[model samples]
Each structure stands twice: as C-alpha cells, then as structure tokens.
Target: MGILSDFFVATPEEALRYANRIEEPDEGDEIEELLDPVQYKRFTDLEITTLWAILEGSDWDVDRHALEYIEIGEDNEAWLNRFPDELTTLLARLEPESQAAVLEAWAGTEELACDPAELQPVVDDLQRLASEAAASEKSVYLWGCL
Candidate 1:
C-alpha cells in the first residue's frame, strides 16, 4: 500500500511559488532538537488529530520519541490526553481489513501523538484488523475515518 508513494516529490513552480517553497531548517522539523517536556503547554483537538495522521507508521517513529509532545502535567503521569472522544472509537466498527488500514493510519498519527500507554491499544487494534483481514478473503487497507 503505497499510500504516500507520490507525496514527497518536490515540484518546481513559478518564481513566487518557488520562493515560498524555500525552506530553512526550522526547529519544529527536528522534534528532538527542542527542550524536553516542552517549554510551553499548547495543544488542541484539531492539532493533535493532524499530528497523529502525519507522524504515525512513518520513519519518524523509528527515530523519534512520543514523549517529545508530552508536557509533564501536575499529576506527573504522561498519557495522550484531550483527544476527541469520537476518535477513540472511530476504528471500532470497521472490518479487520479496514481496521488494519486504520491502525496503519493511526500509527502514522501515533508517531507524534502516541504515548507509551496508548501503544497497547494500538497493537490490539492492529491485531484485530489483521485477524479480520486474514479471515475474510481479502487484504484491506483503510485510510482516515470510514
């Protein structure tokens, strides 16, 4: 499933567009470069959702740490909090193949938002999806919300 197979091509554009394309290395690009536990606390449902989609199941996770996004809260416990309720169950109803796809997608999302606690659920979800995909006669690849 080459979902992002074509997503990384650097295209040439007009002078204006090209100028906008010029990217100097920003601090954000290197997630590890930032101070640990964050210097400021900032998060929103939409932002978390977006980060989840981009980071999980990619090379980013192999090299990065999930704790980078976590800010040590007053409780001193770190888990991914504040995600929308709808997202928690979004993968529940899908077929295993779809679930597998969703899990893959979710992992990509998890690359950034994934916490140590959340990893178990993700593994469970993927296992369910794999079993479903295997039992049926087809291998399915789900992407995004059904």
Candidate 2:
C-alpha cells in the first residue's frame, strides 16, 4: 500500500505531543482513541509538498518550503510534518473555483495522474480543513504511515 496520510488541525504543542506518541508502535490504539476528537481530512498518497504546490499555483518542488519535521519512527517508515502557515493561509483564501483549479492542477501532476473529477471531495475537505485551521489559529500537519 502507498502512504496513508492524514491532514489535521491542532495547536503546535498538541501536534508535537501527538507526533511523538504516534511514533511508538505500542501506542497505536491510544493514538486511534485520541483521533476521535480531532479535526482531520484524509488524503492518501498526496505528499505535503505536492499539496503546497497546488495551492501556490506552482510546479512541484520538493525543496520548496521543506516540510517541518515533527517526529520520525525508528524504522524511518512513518513520520509527521507540518505545513507552513503561509500555505495554510493561501489555501484558506482560495474560492471554490480556485480550489477546483488547484485540484485540476494537482490531478495533472505526473505523480497523481488522475482525473480531477475524482478529487472533488478531497479538495472540498481540504478547503474546509484549511478554513477551520485558519479560523482557529492552528496549524495543519501531515501524519504519514508508509
């Protein structure tokens, strides 16, 4: 399976704590328990950098605003990273049509290579998540399990 990724909103401290705890294999159940109350959107297989480029209307560049590492599992197969506040802000400001355009662009990326129609719900969830995060003055983070 490809990476299982969740984009969620949380305060910096809470995110750090969650990130740290999520790296522990034994804490999987506890982590699931904690996730019950969190605000999140699942976007499997979409890398954070690719999402950022879609929002910024730019080409994919891994080096562009490198994701801030929160934690990495000992096996190096699982990790957490934060999206920049600027990206969050940009995503929040996009209108529905703009959001659709971004989704179209993202679908066109070689890595995604899928029809934009298939991503409508993903874009909708992202727009809502970004808006909520911005309103609450929280950050968006990626928790990825490879």
Candidate 3:
C-alpha cells in the first residue's frame, strides 16, 4: 500500500496533542484518525515532495528528496507551530504566474503524474486551510501514514 497525506487546522495545543499521539500509534489511540479526521485521495511520496518544493520555490525533486513525509510534532515542534504562518506567507508571496508555472510543471512531469486541472482544487484547498488556520491563530499540522 502507498501513503496517504493530509493536514488539519487546530489550536497549537490540539496540534501538538495530535502530533504526539499519532507519532507513536497505540492500540487504543485514535490519534491518527484525528490528525487526518477525514478521508482524502492518497498521494504518493513523490507527489507530496513535489508539492512541498513548489510551495517553497525549491527544486521539485531535490529539495525534499530525503524527506519521507512532514511529520507533525516529533522533532519538528518549531515547524509544526509555525507552518501555518509560513505557508500563508509563501502562498501570498508567490506571483500568480509563478504559481501557474509550478502547477504546470508538476502536471506535465511523468514522475508526479498529476493532472493540472484535477490537482488545482487540491492546491486551492491547502491554501484555504492555511489561510483559515492563520486567521484563527491555529496551527496547521501535516501528517502522513502508510
């Protein structure tokens, strides 16, 4: 089976709680479910890494080549706390043309196998979540499971 990736908007406390719980899954723990909360289309690690690069304006294949996935609160506590703001800032700073270019590149790339039209909505949803999280003073937690 492949990996499924998703994020959620929650208070910093809630984000950390979910992160801590999900990092070490337990028999009674439903934390992973809480972190994701809802079902979503699974994206491969390659596709997710490409998305990360596009958002950060780095090389799509190289920047996150070493990353397995964006774990929530593990050793990345600082990032977990700040991602909402960082994503919002990055999203706001990217020029529209640049955004389109990134999407187009990912769509045409054979490795990612992303369809531009189909992928656009997912991108938009991420932006919306980031924006809402920032506006509400909540943190956005990124999580993935295989």
TM-score each candidate: 0.25, 0.77, 0.58
On the 0 to 100 scale, the lDDT of residue 12 in model 1 is: 21
Best by TM-score: 2
Per residue, candidate 3 scores C-alpha lDDT tens digits across 59-96 of 76554343323345345322232343655555535566
Q: Model 1 compared with the native: what TM-score?
A: 0.25
Each prediction's RMSD to truth: 17.4, 3.5, 5.9
Clashes of each: 9, 0, 0
RMSD of 3: 5.9
Ranked by TM-score, the better of candidates 2 and 3 is 2
Residues 13-132 of candidate 1 have per-residue lDDT tens digits of 121121222133453244223211121122323333543443343332322322122232343222222222232233233444544454445444533354434444544543454344
**Candidate 1 ranges with C-alpha deviation above 4 Å:** 1-83, 106-146
lDDT of 2 by residue, 1-146 (tens): 66666667777776655666655666755754654333333343344568777787687676675777775547577677776788778777878767667777878877677898877766676667778888988877777766
In terms of lDDT, model 3 sits at 0.57
Clashing pairs in 3: none
